[model samples]
Target chain A: MSDEKRYLKLHLIVLALVVIAELIGTKSYKLGPGTIVLLPMLYALLLGLLTGPKFLKIIDKEDMNAAEGLITVSVMLLMAKYGTNIGPTLPLIIKSGPALILQEFGNLGTVLLGMPFALLLGLRREAIGATFSIAREPNLAIISDMYGLDSPEGRGVMGVYVAGTVFGSIFFGLFAGFAATALPLHPYALAMASGVGSASMMSAAVGALVEIFPNMAEEITALGAASNLATGADGVYMSIFMALPMCEWLYRKLIRDRAEEVIKG
Target chain B: MKLSLKDPVVITVIVAILTLVGNFVGYKIDPITAFPGMLILFLIVIVGMWITKIMPGNLPAVVYVSLLGIILTMPWFPLGEKVAELTSQVNFLALTTPILGYAGISLGKDLDSFKKNGLRIVVVAIFVFVGTYLGSAVIAHTVLKLTGQI
Candidate 1:
């Protein structure tokens, strides 16, 4: 197919998916301790996946290729929209600047929590790539550039990047909403937390928050957008300077400790 | 992505048109009315992308784009306030459906590789995401409360 025809086909599918998804609209379910909020974004995502070459095979691989570059573009536009949300709330962001800076240190929790579990699960060197950071596109780039993609580190990073793209946003969406309902924290706090830098994940997370707290949509979105931009800005350097090394040190320690225990035995 | 200068503009126009349909269907706004707001966002993003392309450092284009958007719409900017009012017609969430729809469509290329990576990595990855999210939330909550922002 011609370039025009191919893009046209892919877009038509999206247009249809958007229409159907919006029609179904946002739905919330009460299940035990939390609310599971379903969003049009979810439907659009899953249906778009199903229509891909792997499943129903409705579109071409080239069409999928077209979709790839556009992810960054769409996210740019969305973040630009987020930028608008931030201006009016600039004072609040400045006041909460300390919280924003401190919360990013919370990112270290990935290595802290993930590395030990990965050791227990027998992940080895791959754990360094997998657990060091959130392992989104930029993090994946860092891993590949540092340790060539053929390395174990490469496989570890790729594994998570692939898996993350598939399920990250959907998980964020559901989990954020559930946390908002289940926890005692303000929706604004949860909103600030929702910005993980990765566009789909942050937006879906914010979407869920807005769904549950309709009246606070502006504040929730503004906070989420600011937090997300901060995460993205800090994420690249922090992962390189901090996360990767921490993962490496922890991995070596845990492995050596295990070897020591074996020697004692 | 290989691009001539016009790519952002072309893509923006296309996405804006698509967003118009979704905005009308989902939000009950007329497509005619929403198009102008969508165009405003498209202009900001295009300018942002241009800034990123020429800027010396490696900051993600999103930040620059966002900064520009923020500047152009700030209340004190006078003209920015009008930009904000026009753009507000297109809900920010309206932008997600198209991008995510694109994300989903592109995912097929990676699905098999994901499967090959085995279930172990997927499980650990889930932990990676969960840990970052939960930890960040707890800290943000504590700090917000301490700071009395909430």
Candidate 2:
């Protein structure tokens, strides 16, 4: 098929999905103190997955590749949309206190809980990649560059990167929604944490929050955008100097013979 | 394969138009009403990507797009309020629908790689996402309470 014909087909599929998802509209279920809000975005994502090659195979390789290329471009527009939200609320976000900057340190939670658990799960140096950071594109780039994606670290990062790509946003969406209702945390705080240094993940989490706290939609969107910006802008440096090194130290402390294991296995 | 600037720029325009349909259906905003704001945003997306293309280094286009967005919409910018007003009519949720729809369609090829990652990777992947999100939320909650922002 001609490239134009292929693209037209790909886009038409997406258009139909978008319309159907929007038509279904937003649905909210009350679970505990919080709400489990299912937005059209999630439905659109799931519907796309159902039609994709892994399941229905509605789209061919060329279509997927073409679609993949569009992601970066499409997301930039989304960022632009969200970025406008930041300007008017700049004062509020900054005034929200040191939490704006301090919350970034929370990224370390990955290694804190993930390291020992991944070790318990029987993963090796790969734990470093899996636990060091969220394994988004930037984190993945760091690992791939340092270890060349063929190393244990590379495999570890790639595994999570792909996994995150497929399911990470959905996880964030559900978890964020569930936590908002199940826990006693304030919506603003939860909003800030939704950033997690990745766009889709932040969007999913923020989307759920907006559904639950419609009153705070403006604040939720603003703080989430600001926090995500901070995380993304500063994350690469932090991962290289702080997070990666910390993960290495923890790995060495937990496993006595890093060299021996690699040699033996 | 290297990604040239052309494809994404074209796709951005396509998505801008696509988003209009979604905005109309979901948000009840007429396409004509959302057109101006969408045009402004579309221009920003293009200019931001263009800046990244010409600029040195490998920074993602998003960083530039985001920074430019903040700058152009800030109070000092002459058209900031107008821009904000027009764009506000275009719902944020509307923008996300097509983006994820595209993402969903693209997910099939990655499934094999994800499956090969095994159960352990999936478990660990969940841990990583949970840690980042929950950890940050907890910290934010604490700081807000301590500082009385919440």
lDDT of 1 by residue, A1-265 (tens): 7877777777788889888878887776654323455667667878888997768989878888877666655566676677676666555556557878788878888898888987787778878988888776556445644664435775677677666766677778878888888988788778878888776688888988898999999989988888887776567668877888888888989999999999999
TM-scores for candidates 1 onward, in order: 0.67, 0.69
* Candidate 2 lDDT score at position B25: 88
Q: Write the per-residue lDDT of candidate 2 for residues A148-188, one digit (tens) a residue.
A: 44457866776776578666777888889998999998999
What TM-score does model 2 achieve against the real structure? 0.69
> Judged by DockQ, which candidate is best?
2
Over B37-79, each residue of candidate 2 has an lDDT whose tens digit, in order, gives 9988898888987898899987666667767777777787898
TM-score of predicted structure 1: 0.67
The per-prediction tally of clashing pairs is 0, 1
In model 1, the number of clashes is 0
Question: Per-candidate interface C-alpha RMSD?
Answer: 5.2, 5.0
